[model samples]
Target chain A: MSNFNLKVPTMASMMANGETPEILFWVGCAGSYDERAQRVTQAFAKILNHVGIKYAVLGTDESCTGDPAKRAGNEFLFQMQAMQAIETLNGYKVTKIVTACPHCFNTIKNEYPQLGGNYQVIHHTQLIADLVADGKLKTKDNKVFKGKRITYHDPCYLGRGNNVYEAPRFALEALDADLVELKRCKQNGLCCGAGGAQMFKEPEKGTKDINIERMEDVKESNASIVAVGCPFCMTMLSDGVKNIDNLSHTAVLDIAELTALSNNL
Target chain B: MAIIAQILFLLAFISAVTLFYKNFKKILRNIQLGKSISRNDNKKLRWLMVLKVAFGQSKLAAKPIAALMHFFIYAGFIIINIEVLEIIIDGLLGTHRIFLFLGGFYNFLIGSFEFLALLVLFAVFVFLARRLVLKLKRFSGAEMTAWPKKDATIILLTEVVLMFAFLIMNASDHQLQKLGQAHYPIAGWFPVSQYLQVVLPTSAQALVFLERFCWWLHIMGIFAFLNYLPYSKHLHIILAFPTTWYARLNNLATLDNMATVTNEVKAMLDTSLVPPTASENATFGANDVHALHQIQLLNAYTCTECGRCTEVCPANITGKLLSPRKIMMDTRDRLVEVGQNIDRNGNDYVDGKSLLGNYISYEEIWACTSCNACVQACPINIDPLSIIIDLRRYAVMEQSQAPNSLNNMFANIENNGAPWKYAAADRLNWANNLSN
Candidate 1:
């Protein structure tokens, strides 16, 4: 079946059978090309399957979704690439798309319709929240994720573009994590320097790279770990944490990783 | 003398009609400055703008006192023409007293018209004092493109002097039937004209000859003004109403894309729709007068220098390079300049000067956030955002020169899925633990 199943914490994943699909994880560029994102998505897919929710994967047969090309003024190319993905999704009979990559979520959900590629797109945090709301998955309950000082990076696409400030926070709060929010979060969240395809091109002449500036705020929080809702944010912030020697122990963790580790920890 | 006046009047009447008819065609034809397809739109709203602003003069009335003075003065010009007609008729019939033909019917109309004439004169006086004496500090930035302070100063001065002379110099009319009841009451005991009239022996009817003499000067002054109008900043007077009437529906404060999601396009655009073999130097954006789109050209003509755009402009406030008024003025001035040259089979400009290094410099273009505030404040509806974007389109698509941030973004869009140089391989890195 198509990995197009979308599950929410409190709601059924799919309309049928009362069980929401396990994961609406969007397999994005990092999944297709970077191997690490591929490994994470694959692992998440396996975890969802083991948890007994019907699922399907959509992007395996697709091409580059042209969110990058369009923002870069190569609308001509973006059109061709976006059309291919739209056709693939149609062929897979996919109804909803989910992703941990803010860029993929934004492009596929927001920009795709600009190019006539319309589909229901969401983020993985949204699905995880839905699961918790439905009481489908059991948690550690002892609060394995509790008491450590931590901060969350509001990925621009998730926070600003889609207004998804709550889903990630809900997931983090469910783990009983002590959250230290940076100065810039929610509505006024800074860009992670990856939007509008800036990740592919060189950063323009801005005061500072938005991602590094965001990382500085996270460092200022002195949180031991930096949590993220987006894969691109995870990588940029992880790199940011690694660079500041003092803050290197402040590791970057996705909500999924924290959620899965909650039971084990 | 009567025949001479008749011939000049007929000649002037014909010239005015012909010139108005011809230039109207030229403006209608020069709608597009070059070849490019743009959104074709909003006809009903355009009519509404015309009906409300031009025909009704609704916008002018927003400031009540000025509007009243202006209405009386403008209506005065129309009614005074009847007096001119009576004069011409009398002159042709070889009589100095013209209203004798229609008996009291003709004289009554002339008397009423003369009454309007007197009001027009004072209305012009009020307009002059409002600008010069009280001096709305709005004129401090008297480079005068937006506020039209200099033009107002000139027009107001000329009107006051002409009306003053018009009152004094015309003392020879035998036709000015004395309203024995003093119906044309002088509002106040004025200095020059009222005293000078006292010295004239009673109705040898000097007001008759005085009216005729002043009438010629008034009519001739108007004719000279008409000829001078197309060359002056005051051209907006002639252009404003029609331009306002035919204006595009402007999206104020926030620019709305015409291409909303529901618009249907084929899977791929048809190649036939694209023009083949455009000129190598042909401007893709507004390079010359003809390259400007119709609404773009419309914006040039419809400006009413109320200074609202300048007043709210952040750049003007912060003392920055951006001036919305300058952009509008420079674009229009350049178009008029180049349009004249084109009429002579001489092109004084190309795309490079007007678009790339505009009078409003390129740096100023970057400073704009595509904010429609300037667009919003323009009472006559100038879309500064669209103009800025059109030039940006030329710079980015045609010239391949965009800002460094955009360059990086484009590069990342090509390589990574987004703009930040985040590892594309780490895309799923955020999903590491959602599963329980």
Candidate 2:
């Protein structure tokens, strides 16, 4: 399998243009771990800072959001973890929070209410899209790349759980990448088979591997590079690219990474 | 014609029809979808079930004592048609127990029916024991947060008293004509009434008056019971046949198709997707009771209050705050609230508070797994799973509020080629690994 690492960005930006933001960023698990995700989170934060949105990050204290536990049916672990996250977020007086992990984003935004944790949460792509629309993240890189064909995979956590479909698409479009549609595009998008604890346990019973199935859909487009919004999908799909030698040339990069790459960062 | 007999004959026949009609309307409106009981379908299973349950008494026989008790009651009640015919001809028309042919056999049949009535009385004592003393879970009350054991006790006692009274009236009359009051052959066989016979005067006037009084009480008690049926466990008595009949044909837990309110989502509005709740009624699935159509209500009326649905429900078992029975009751409670609202201002049901929201919280709405176990367990063929799914559809499509996973899941569906938000260019990458 192909390999990629997830690393998160810094929160040095939110106040660049002098705007007090309503929420804070909690760069999620995959962002902290994946190299490409780290760059995206950091660059997005820089863009937000450039745009003047005030924010804070929970820093080292940020841990795994309880989504993994809940999906695994260990609801007790999910509750405990969620309560801990909520208590930490509350300490920051954070009314709104943002994360790059689709699973984290889902847990913080959607499922946390079950544990009495209520806060307005948005995925990082949504914040980036907003910042771009507000003209904080200049699309100077948009004019440079002429023929960089790319496709996206819907990580179940981000795709099905949070419903942040368009924001990343808008971000990708804004980044000057050639967008190609997949046959099973949107809604019917097959699972990377990573959500609902499939990432941890053995998959129930499908012939093909989950991420392999997802990557195959992406490879069918023959896109030179694939853009991903969620880090877990990045790791799984990136690894999925290596199974076929000829498909070896295909590269999986985060939407953030693609944006950062286009920016000459 | 005797005035009493003429009045009773009309009342009994009319009362049965009236009770049948009321229940029939509910099933027609709720389950049949504009059709009454059989719009045209195979009834072999229904036939088999009727033969097994109604005649063979298989369902009752499974619980021997309860079966014996029920057997007495139903058998007594069924054969009592003989007594009814006798009353119409001999008692009402003043014909003196005369048979043109097979007089011995006819008398023997009457005697057998009279004996069965006494056995029926003895059997009812067992039914009372089951309904009151043992308190089966199937007979739990509407909420079942607590089982009200007393109400069932009273109803069972009343049935026994009234039915035995009818038998006493028949037995005493038969004795006067066939055996004489002194010998008391038929009355002697009935221990409860025979003891009372000893205390009363041996005069024919007293015998007639007692018979008349007992006859009036029996018939009136029957009418009162009919009216009380829809409101009590006795509703099951009327509902059981159709429930069993439908259960024989339809898979109760299998949900009906949801009314498609999403309009197939014609154009992908990426930047400006319409809010999910854009149905003409601003509804998806079952936003309101009428959104439920008729079969849903049939599910409500047909519920046996057995708690089998509740016990098998994974959501309830998982501590998710949803029970299949509670879902049914929520529908019931919603119907009541909406019904009251519609009554107050016809077609203004839209303004009232949601009865579903009060009991079936939004969290509870989404917790359901759509498993059909509850459907499978329902003896009446009520499908709670369908109702739950419809409500979930309403919550998602119309309400625009859904469980977190659901919202993102739909988003993923709308966007990242799957429920996952991966880039489209990556779709074929996985094919690289598999040997073509």
- Chain A of candidate 1: what's the TM-score? 0.83
Q: Who wins the DockQ comparison? A: 1
Q: For model 1, how does the per-residue alpha-carbon lDDT over B5-63 read when each residue is reduced to its tens digit?
A: 77777787668657766765555555455334444367677778867776566756646
Q: Report the C-alpha displacement of residue A8, candidate 2, in angstroms.
A: 36
- TM-score quality measure for candidate 1: 0.56
Number of backbone-clashing residue pairs for each candidate, in the order shown: 58, 64
Q: lDDT of each structure?
A: 0.58, 0.58
At residue B165, give the lDDT of candidate 2. Answer: 77
lDDT computed for candidate 1: 0.58
The CAPRI-style docking tier of model 1 reads incorrect
